[model samples]
Every structure is written in C-alpha cells, then in structure tokens.
Target chain A: MKIEVTSQMTGNVWKVVVAKGEQVEEDQEILILESMKMEIPVVSPDDGTIIELKVEEGDFVSEGDVIAILEED
Target chain B: MTKQVVEEQNELKQKIDKLLEKKEKYREMGGQKYIDAQHEKNKLTARERINLLLDEGSFKEMGILAHHQNLHPTMEGKFTPADGVVAGRGTIDGREVCVAAHDYTVLAGAIGKVAETKVARVREWSLKNRVPMIWLVDSAGVRVQESIGSLFAGNGRQFFDQVQMSGVVPLICALMGPGIAGTAYLPALADFVPMVKKTSYMALGGPHLVRSVVGEDVDEQTLGGSRVHTQESGVADLEVKSDEECLKVIKKYLSYFPSNNEQKPPIKEGVERAEITINERLAEIVPTNPKKIYNMYDVIKELSDDNDILAMKPKWAKNIITAFGRVGGYPVGFIANQPMHLGGALDGDAADKAARFMNICDSFNIPLVFLQDIPGFIVGSKVEKAGIIRHGAKMLHMVSEATVPKITIIIRKAYGAGYFVMNGRQFDPDYIAAWPTAEISVMGAEGASSILYHKQIRKAEDSKAAWSEYADQFRNLIDVEVAASNMLIDDVIDPRETKLQIFDAVASAWNKKVERPWKKNSIRPV
Candidate 1:
C-alpha cells in the first residue's frame, strides 16, 4: 500500500523535506506543512517508498487532503 | 393616673439599677475592657459598615443583641451576645443586600452557639429577601473553648442556607483576616472571594494540624498564604495587599454584574480613555531573525491603556501571563505566554491557571485577547508523570467551549498543539493578527531540520555545516512572504498599533446577545 499522508489542517505547505519515490520508514516525517502559520508534519504511517507527491512545492492543502502517497515495498 | 405613672417610673428605675449592678460586676471580672476592645475593632462599627455598604441608616438589624443564656445551674455565667456576628439588611449603593460582618476580636470572632444562630438568621434573610448577600469573614473558625457543642450547633443549617442561596443571588464573601479551617469554606462556596494579603489565610486546618495529620512540617504562610492560594492551586480570584483595597475590588467586581441576574447590565459611559497612539516607526518593531526574542510584556504594556493593566497571579504564572486590562477604557481579559520563562511553554500549572481564568471571564461576558508566542507544552517523562495530557486537554476543551469574543495575536512563535490552544483559527477566533517576525511552524527550524532533513545533510562532507545550511532554508518557510500567501491570519499589524486594532475588533462585536436560564451564575466544577 502506498503511504498516503494528508494534511490534518488547512494552510500553505511551508516546506518539503523529502523528494518523490524517497525511501521512508514507519513514523518517518516526509514534509512540514504550515496552516495558520503552524507547521504540521506529514509522516509515513508504515515503512514504504514515496511513489507520488500530490501537492507540489508551496501548495495549500485542506483537512484530510493527501499531501503525499508512499508505495510499500 | 399621676400616681400610677410614678409607680411605673419606680419599677423602671429598679430595673436600671439591676443592669448597672450587673455591668459593675462584669467590670470587676475584666469583661468590660475585653468586650469594649472587640466592639471597637469590628470591620466597621454596626452603623459605619452598614452605612458604607448599605444605604445610610437603612439597615434594620434583625436580631440586634440577640443572645444565649444558660438555664442549667452549672452553666449560669456563660452567655454570648450575637456571638460576635453582625447580620442585617440595607441597600448597597441603591441595591438591597443582606450582610454579615464577623467581629474578629470577639473570641477571635469564632463561631459559637449564639453566633451560629445569627449566621443562620442572616442566611435565611438572604434567601427570603432575594437580595444579594455580602459576608465579611474575619474569623478563626470554630471556638476551641466551646468545642463540640458549637460544632454540633453549626453543623447543618449554615451549609443548607449557602446551597439554597447559590446562583440565585450573588453571595460575595471577603476574607479580611486569618480565615482558618471551617471558616475558609465560606469563601469556597462564595461567588467571589477578595482577600487581603498577609492578613488572610484560608485552609482546611492550620499548619500544626496539617503537619500532624499529613506527616509534613510547614509554617502557616507556607501552608495557606495568599500567594500560595492565588498562584499555585488556582483558588483566590483577586488578592489585594490591604483591607481598603479588598473593599475596592469588591465594589468594582460588583459593578460588572447586576444585583441579581434578573436585571440588565448597567450602561457604561463607553468612555474611550484617550486614543492609544503608536509611533509610525513601530511598524518595524519586530526583528526578522527567528532566533531573536522580544519582550512580550513591553509590547503588551505599550498596547494597553496607560497604567491600566491589572495583572493577576503575576508572580506565580510568569510564562503564561494573565491580566484584566482596559484598551481605550473598555475592559478585556488578556492572556499572553511569556517566552522568557520556560521558552513560553505551557506547564500543567499554567494550563490549569489560564483555563480557569478563561472560563471565568467567558462566563461573565468579557472579551478575550490571547497573546500567542508559544513553543509547545513542556515535554518529558517527568511532564507525562504529572498528567500533563489531561491538564493540557482541559485547556483545549475550555478554549472550545468559550463563547466570548476572542482575538489572537501571534507575536513570535506558534508551534504544534500550542497554536490550537492559543486561540488559533481552529477555535474560530474573531480575528487573528501576526507580527511579521512570527515563525508559525510545527516545530522550530533546528528541530525540524534535525529530524526530517537528517540524511540530506549527513551525505554532505561537513555534516555540521550542512545542517546549519538546511536550518536557514527551513527558517525561510516562516517569513512574511509565506504568511501573505496563506489567508490563515487576518492581518499583520504594527506592534505598537496592536492595542488600537484589538480594541476596534472587540468594540465591533459589542452588543452580542446570548440568553440562558434566569439564574445562570456558573457554579464552578468542584
């Protein structure tokens, strides 16, 4: 299964820490999203590889909208 | 008929002689000076306290000089008069109220057999009159000399009266002296308790008793000082240094509410206390560096009306500040966390203090100004053991339940759940403003870079140097340019102009109408 990490709150994506198809582990943080000027982490829930990053650099995401998806090996 | 009148006059003279002889006998036994001194030291003489609180000469003393005398031969000499409590009825600044003032010097104003009856009478009067009740408690709890008999007399009637009167009419109790043991609980059930520092002490038992009961040793101040009560455990509402200040707080607090909940709020002058001016140069007051810290107190002080900030528990909750300050002469509750203390983190004590203050202000229809500059709650295994999760969540729940007008100002840092707890947009703040220097992120740049971008920097030849380079890039995410792209915060206002903007925002929300039950004096959770 892919690592589908979505935003928990709505705000601008302040920073991207990982690139597409990057290897990730369970509980590994993938990116930092800023909403209401607060940075929230988009992390991997399971050990996987990022297949597709839905939001590009500096894109805004809503609550529960996917920010990135990871493909499990 | 003239002979009959002469006979009556002779009988009166005989009675007067008997009273004079009794008075002389008491004087011989040293009762005269002791009774006279006690009568002199009463909070105010019956006439004066009544006049100051009630209409001049309006109070009708229900049971003046009501006393208890012994019918049994062994108890012949033991008689108590009003048991040192003065309870009566009169108007307080035009509003009628039932009042009870304890006479401190009289047996240290201890509750005795006759005094408990007087307390019951005034409590009953408060219930029957439907007027507000103001108690001036300056007692040393129950009389040790009277002991079990007095406790048995006072056991049930007084509490039943307080319970029946709660929320129906505002019962204001002022602890003006050494309030030990059972006497402390009077204020515990009161709608408000205004205490005088050093003079007042409220505890279930005195230090000696506490030491004996709990196997701990401490003095009275260490046990029940005003500082301990107001700041540590979150008990006392307002603490004044003297008795005069206590009376003033009582008057001011009463001004906010009606005599009873049935009436409407008194129309204020809406007097603008001079326009709070800001220097044009204040726009650049916030520095660009994320690491550079500014004194939030200076900013808050400059934004408030000149000499108008009334800080509460100031010395205790240093990091999380709370005050009742006037902006343009309109009162507002201000809550700001000072980053200088523990990096502006919310500890269990601060969270509990702020949450309690918020609930009280919101219940009274006061507007709130939450100054946000927080890193997060203090995190560690130690904090976990202190039940920080439960206490922190309690604050979050209070923020959600608050129905008052809320304005959030992001002065510097807003990270993690601290943002949500600090009147963030998720709680539907009426307006959210930020200083351009604020870095609103999940975590600080160094922490984020260390945890998330570790590999990218580790691959570089100089890992330490590469880590520093990545931190700067992460800091760039929290600049004014990024904030402008997101509409989360309403506006980035000048640091000096914050007061004027917040006043305008709150004034615009004035005349907000919300109705509830007729008797809605919120009884706090036990």
Candidate 2:
C-alpha cells in the first residue's frame, strides 16, 4: 500500500530527515516544518519505505499538501 | 381449629408460588438461544454488564417485571421481558447511581413504549435523588412493530428529559453493541461515552437504512464504529477492546466524579503518600528548547497520583489533551497542550475539545489543572474558513465562566491568546506559575519582529541580517523573569517541583468561591 504523507500545518520545511528509498518506522520524523515559531515534525504514519520525496529543505508547504509518498513495509 | 383457617392458608401459599414463577421466566430474558448468540459475538448479556459495573450485591432493580402495553396488530400475542430494558438504582464503588441496560436478547433490545417509560422513570429517579445516571445501550432503535404508525407522535420524551437532567448530575452511556437511530441519541447527550471496539456501534441510521434511504451500501462498522466516533467524528470519549474492558473503564471514570453536583468529589483515602513529593522525572521528560517537541503524557503521568489518568477523547484533536486524574488523591481535570502535533497550535477542533472538557470539570466540581505549552490558534485562510474565531471564543467563554479551582503551569511557550485561554492570570486562575523556560508574550518574537521591524529591515542594505538582529533582540526581551518581576504571573518555579506545586495550589483553593450577578444564562459561542 502507498500512503501520501501530508503537512498538517502551513509552514516552511526546515529540514528533510529522510531520503528516497529509505525505510522508516511509524512516527519517525520525515520532515520538520517551522510554523508559529515552533518545529512541527511530519511523521510517517506506518512502517514504510519512502518511495517519493516531494519537498526539500526551505520549501514552503501548505496544510494538507502531500510532502512525501511511502510504500508500506 | 376451624376448617376456614386451613382453606385461607392454602390460598395464600398458591399466590406466592405463582409470583415466583413469573419472576423466574422474566429473568431468563428472551430464552437461552439469544443469550448464547450474544456470547458468540463477544458481548455480555444486559444483566451480566450491570453486575460487573455495580458493586457486589449492590444493585436494587426497579422495573424487572415491566411488560409492554403496546396493542398494535403486528404485536399480537407477543411477550417482552422487562419491556427489553433492565433499569434500577445501584452502587458503584459504594456510591449510588441509576442504570439502564438494554436487554438485547429481547426483541434485539428495541425500545418499546413500556421500555421507554422504564428508562424515563430511572432517569427521573437519578435526578430526584441527585445520583449519577449510566446507560448501557445496545438496542436496534425503537421497536418498529409496536411504533410503526401514527402512534409515534407521543414518543421522544427521553431525549427531552435528558436535556433537563444535563449538568445536574453526571451521565454515562456505554455502547456495548449496535445503537442505531433512537439508541444513538442516548450517548449524544451523555457526559462520557465509551464504545466497545468490535461489538459496539452508534449511528443515526443503520447500514440497512442507509442503503435504502441514501442508496449508499455501507457496513455497520464503517458507518459508526468505535474508531469512527472516537477518532473521526469525536462523538464517543473512549474505545475499549471488549465488554469487560468497557465496564471496567466506566467504574474508573466515575471515581473522579461525585454522585451529584451538590456534593464534593469523593476523595480516596489511605493514599501511600498524601503529601506531594518532588519528582525529578518531570524535568527529564520536557525539553527546555522552545522548538523541540515532547510527549505531554510523560509529564502528566509523573504528576498524576499512581500514574493513573483517564484520558477523554484521546485520539481526537491530537493537539490538545483532556484527561481526568487525581493529584494528591484529589480528582482534577488536566487540559494540556501536546507540542508534538501541529506545533501545539489550537485549531477549531482542539478548541472545542478543550472547551467541552472544561465545562464538564466545572459542572462536576472537579478542579482543573492547565499545562500550557501552546503557540496560538492556527492562523491563515484555511482556519479562517473553518470558523476558528467562533471555536476559539467558545474556549475563551468557558475558561472565563468556569468557577472551579483552576491551577496553571506554563511549561514553555505561552504566547498570544493561547495563554489567556489556558487559564492565564487574566482568567482568574487560582494559582498560575511558569517554568524558567516560559515565555509569556503577545506573540512570538519571530512573527512580531517581521511585522514591527519590516520597514527597518527592508531599508537596510543587508535585509536578512537586519531581520535576524531585530528578531534576536525581540526574543531576548521575551523572558520569564520579566513577568515574575512585574508580578504578572504568580511565581516562577523549577520544573522538578511542578507536581508538588500543583498539589499545593489545588489544596489551597479547595474552598474557592466566586460571586456573580444572576442572569438567565450568558449567550455562549458555538
């Protein structure tokens, strides 16, 4: 199953912690969003491998915008 | 010895035998076949559930022999045991409460006309006696056979009676099986609703009704299961795995509440430590950095008595947490901000959750403890369209109106209106304290600097550097000591002593009283 990880808040991507084809556990931070003067981590919802990386460091993403795609393990 | 004396004695014995026979038959509850089927689905019978919830041998049943009076042509020669409802007064943990459990073995636990009367009578008994009411609903809605025609006009007094009983005493509704249509409203007006994972569901319309009326073929679980209500719809409070767990949770939930609004919450005695002790783990669980995230549950568990907390609506509105726990053996409701989700920003749903929890705590006389680490309400076009203002106002109104003893601990960022809604100094919190890392300000330095120093930064040759310099200066001004020195907040304390501090604050304000001019009621925000 493929799952699209989306940004929960409209903010600038402060950092990308995972790379394409990288395996990640559930709740592992995929990227950090800086909004409202706080760091909000967008995490993987399930244990999966990143099949697509859609955003890079310093990129702005709106709330509900898909930031990464994961292939379930 | 006259012959008349022997004849009278024989007649009395015969009457007693007939009464015992009737009681035995009604107690069987729709026969053994239906009872076995209920067990196959991992659900307990109505009597079994009531037994588990109340104390041993404490239940005093009130309408066990009630039979339906419905005379519709479809109901000819039909027999209903207790009118499909088992209702009466009982004691949970030795405290009085009234309960109504739907006997699903009888007519699938449909609410017949007489069953409705039985439930209404119990509800009235709860109110008149000022005792808490619990409803174990597992019905297939109203009995259509008995209520299919124009006779339905006289129905629906239970909901109206529930509205009148609201806030006067605690109401708990547990969905142990399907609660379709009329059965769903029982939980809708309840204070606490727990749903059994696989066996329980509540929907205004069942799957069959949806298929026929809307032409959408949805299953029972998909339509309104534990996950749907507890996670998505925010209708139910907690989801338990089985009927046994559901009954156990109800007992735990009631421990934090009083029998009625007029009485003080029953304080547990013989706590290993009545006095609060300084726990060093609190400092380790929270990060001092403003941007870093930590689980609020870790801090809550360390502060709560015996690490016991009943989290309400735990899965819904992940940004804000509402839970019931005891501090130094005193029951209190904790409203904390979860920094891990959405930067701990309050959204419409989060606001609604917090506000409703606050109302419950206030109504039940349970003190409230707020742990603030909020940034502010989520801003922008998206939230605006979602009516964040109305939702935010509802929280603001609730905090202002809540007369219960309120204790606040500013764990970290307490910026903007977030501080106000989280029982800040302005909301008349009984005791408001901040940690060394707390920043009480109108807004964060980064956002404020961008707007206040916009012209200065734009005019400078090095705008980026100028902006950073200005923002740093603003950040330096946002200090916890400034508020403490000015006496804006009560005190600045060490993070390690938070539990002891909160316990002291709650104990000191145990007799708090606030006076206000009487009115019908203030118009609260939606």
Separately for all candidates shown, the number of backbone clashes (residues 3 or more apart, or on different chains) is 5, 0
Model 2 C-alpha lDDT per residue in residues B1-526, reported as the tens digit of each score? 6899988988898988888899889989988999999999999999999999999999998888899887778788878989898999989988999999999999899989889889988999999999999999999999998778788898889889888888999999999999999889989999999999879999999999999999999889889988789877999999898999999999999999998888888878865454677788988887767667888988899989889899999878889999999988889999999998977889999999999999999998999999999888888888899999999999999999999999999998898999999999999999999989898888888788989999999999999999999989999999999998999989999898998888888878988889888999999999
Model 2 chain B lDDT-worst window of ten: B269-278
Q: Candidate 2: misplaced stretches above 4 Å?
A: A1-7, A10-62, A65-73, B272-275
lDDT of 1 by residue, B1-526 (tens): 6999999999999999997776445222224565466445443333334456655778776655555443545435754455567778877666778888776645566776667777788788777777778888877787655554544553656666787787567778887766788788788777677777766778889887888899888776667767567656556766776666776666666654455544433434555635557645344544565434445566666666665566656655566888776667666778888754455778887887788778656755667899888988877777799888888886788887777778898888888788888888788788888876676888877778888788988798998988988888888786744664688778887777777788888887655555545654444332
Q: Return the TM-score for each candidate structure.
A: 0.71, 0.92
Best by TM-score: 2
Judged by whole-model lDDT over C-alpha atoms, candidate 2 comes out at: 0.91
Candidate with maximal lDDT: 2
User: What's the distance in Å from true for residue A5, model 1?
Assistant: 48
Candidate 1's fnat? 0.00
For model 1, the DockQ equals 0.02
Interface root mean square deviation for model 2, in Å? 1.1
